[model samples]
Target: MKKLLYFEQDSSRIRPIVVALSKHFEVSVAGDLLELAATLRQKEPRILLFGLASLPGAFSIHILDRIKQIMLNLHEEKLASRSALSVVVMHGDDSRWQQICEPYIAALREIPFCDIYVIPAATNPDELAVSIINIKRANRHLRTARMSATAEVPIIGNSTKMRHVIEQIRTYADKHHPVLIVGETGTGKELAARALHFWGKRSHHHFVALNCATIPETLFESEMFGTERGAYTDASTRMGAIEQADNGTLFLDEIGSLSLASQPRLLRVLETGEYRRLGDPHPHSAQFRLVSASCINPIDLAAKNKFRSDLVYRIADLVIEIPPLRHRAEDIPLLAAHFCSHFSKDAFSLEQNALDKLCAYHWPGNVRELRSVIARACANNSTGRIFADDIQFLYQWKFEGNSQPEVSA
Candidate 1:
């Protein structure tokens, strides 16, 4: 169960709510900074709730610094648990609490808090319990994305290659430089882009995405650079993906598919962090971290005149390569088990023969193919064990080197 360390000025008013939440959370009460420090020293709760209506009489900058220091110390010592613990403040009314925390709100917000939101004044116990549970789960997912990269990102693989991928994500999550994610189709390139955005400083802002492959070449200007009222025949004032993603991240997928015409706009933003909306000559400023993905090596595309070399160099300050599933076949069983547990409504397990069959076939489509196989078995077979006969490889395609060969089962 997740734990909560709560601090309140008057213990009497919040005591009842505490008792009700004790059933769901391991709850501990702290009346003052001294007690709060004692509690922090003794235990590492997943969430810390500052449930006070007003600031404590003993509040001071020194005390505040100490609290942050202790939390940081705990984080370093428990690297695995760092992503799980969160600090949040809850209150029913904002007026008093706002006044109380206005000075320190900026400093607290500067801390990597999972969230800061409103709540009932210790009144609705049931609703708060559910909310707490939901918040805990959501934070855990984000934390998983940050710490394990692929493990918690819902990507479901634990190979040595995958661990390095996760490490790269954590490394680039904080920087402002553009990132290029290179991988084969179905290699979860977009998923890694999301991890970079959400686990980074830009997470609190918007995450705008544009898939160049799906977008028409004619609409690149309007879709990426924004437009103003009367900019076109019927265009109203609008912000494009770059403007919308200001102060956040803009992920461009299949970036190698971008024509030379659209590459200028992308290169302009990376070079100057500036762009003008269509019809409106007034250049609007947009500051965003750029993350681009492609199935092919973008530089190679540039060399072939399919992409601009200058643009390719600008977008690829850090390149992350996602290995194909066939290379990391060791993760197949774990990935298969993860999918079965997720898609199966009933209790389920895969037989040894079934597992062998899954591991034997080459997954040209990677984890995505594995998920489909498991999902199909769960839908067609009984709730019990699924044998080799029950598991089927519907697709007759497999990869051998760069060429795909057809094989009869």
Candidate 2:
């Protein structure tokens, strides 16, 4: 059984709830900060449940700061990895409790891997226990999926915008609603889509991706709805992207390129999970989550009458806008170093001048273009170090309306 550590000023008040939870978890109670930190270090509980209602009225920012310090220290020391330590704040609906715990709740929310559960005052002990159990189950699944998917889909960046993007992905990954990702080309829209699939409840199911721009207008229906035997010349029974993504995720990349004629057909499937094969009369139902990406703004396309507004609303229940590389320029060095290490077998280092050059130029093609430049530089450099001279910008002349930067021989 997993260990659960609960902290409260008055533990006796929540004894019934603890007793109910004890059946599933090895429950430990802490009445003070010292005991809480000690148990966290020694027992290393999987879940930390903070009972905000039972905290004393004397709770101050000093105390909250101390708690935040403890968590930060533990995180820095690797004693509590983000995936290992799950912090849950539980409080009642009482207005007094809410007023008292509001700041503390906000503080905990800033901590990674922390979640807040607001329990109504009328909720019985058994119901609260069940809810906590379900929370534990979800945390376990998320932790497992995160650990497994980290290597496969590495989203590298520490800038504020990138952090916001990551947090949005985490917040909406487990939801069943359709998600629309809008950004410029080469902004890693497909990467964000993959992160959503790999980190969600559907991680075990297949993740099917289709590029709307690549499909021919004549073949759109057959590609999306599959084909039955004799549907066309030498056509055999085959599954479509919808059927392939059943119970999983369907990623339509560059959805803005979808033909206007094909828009209504796709919208019908989104409205009702029903699609028919080219030759088959009977309709088949597929229950899969939709994750669509487009370089052009869907709203703008709809306004111009090139795309359907209703379809846009249906696909964009949640929207994640990825900032272009130039917008998050601070992440350039990190991305450059990552690309250097990935493309070269031997150890490669970037000089200060090289990094300065990388950060100075405006990346028109975004991260993908940066990766290509890094690969070429790494391959051409005889020494293991990359310098400003070795760095080349393919579109230097196009910068700032055809004015080019000076190059050194």
Off by over 4 Å in 1: 1-152, 397-408
Deviation from native of the Cα of residue 243 in model 1, angstroms: 1.3
Q: Which residue pairs show collisions in model 1?
A: none
Q: Return the TM-score for candidate 1, rounded to 2 decimals.
A: 0.62
Q: What is the lDDT of residue 306 in candidate 1?
A: 87
Kindly list the per-residue Cα lDDT of model 1 for residues 1-409, writing each as its tens digit: 6678887776565677687778889998887777887787686676787665444423533444556666556556653244435565554444344445444544544555334332334345554565566556545544553454432356557899998998999999999889999988888899999888877776755567789998787899888986655677977555578766655688999998888887887788788766777886545455678899999998889778889988888999999999998888888888888888888876679999998898888887877778888888888887578888777675864767988554446
Top candidate by lDDT? 2
C-alpha root-mean-square deviation, candidate 1: 12.3
Displacement of the residue 273 alpha carbon in candidate 2, Å: 0.6
